[model samples]
Target: MSSLALHVADKRPEDPADLTGFYAGLLAVLNDAALNHHGWTGSVVADLGEIGGYVYMKIRPGEGDEPFATIEDLRAFRKRQAEEARRTEEASKQARLI
Candidate 1:
C-alpha cells in the first residue's frame, strides 16, 4: 500500500466558491474511481480552507486481496466525522452557557 498527498492551490480564483468547486471536482474523480472499481482499496482525506486545500489518500488491498471500500463509504465516513465534530462543538457551547 502506498500513501499519496496532493496539495492544490488556486490563486487565479478570487472567489472562494470557484476554488471550492474545483476541489470538489477533483474529489469526485477519485471517489468515482473507487465506486467503479472492485479491487480498489483506498480512502481520501480532503482538507479545504479559504487559502487552498490538500488531499491525502491511501491505497491498500483488502483482506483476501479484494476491494476495500467505495466512494460512498468514504463520504459517509467524512460525514460522520464532521457530524461528531459539530456535536462536540455544540456540547461545548452548551456547557459554557450553563
Candidate 2:
C-alpha cells in the first residue's frame, strides 16, 4: 500500500548559520541511508522567521490505488498514452511495408 510520512519539527534559530547547519545535517542523514529505494522520495519545507524557524520533511511511498495522488499515478499516467500511440503507428507502418 502507498503511504505518506511527514516529519514536522518546530525550531527556533538563533542565527542564519543555525538554519543552514540544520538543513545540512538533514541532507547528510538522507544521503547516508542505503535502503532508500522502491518509490521512496523525500522533500523538506522550511518556514523562516526572524527569531526562529520550523521545518517539515515529508517522505512518500508509492503503491496501490486510492483516492489520493500516488507517485505511481503521475508516472503511470504520464506519456503512457503517447508511447502507446507511437508504437501503434510504428506497427501500422510495418504492416504497410509487409
Query: How do the residues 33-95 of candidate 1 rate in per-residue lDDT, one tens digit apiece?
Result: 554653345444544333344444433333354443445555665687789889999999999
| All-Cα superposition RMSD per candidate | 6.3, 15.3
List ranges where model 2 is wrong by over 4 Å: 27-52, 61-98
Best lDDT goes to which candidate? 1
Clashes of each: 0, 0
Q: Model 1's lDDT to the true fold?
A: 0.52
lDDT of each: 0.52, 0.43
Q: In candidate 2, which residue pairs get closer than 3 Å at backbone N, Cα or C atoms, i.e. clash?
A: none
Where is model 1 more than 4 Å wrong at Cα?
1-51, 58-66
Worst 10-residue lDDT window, candidate 1: 1-10
Q: Can you give the TM-score per candidate against the true fold?
A: 0.40, 0.31
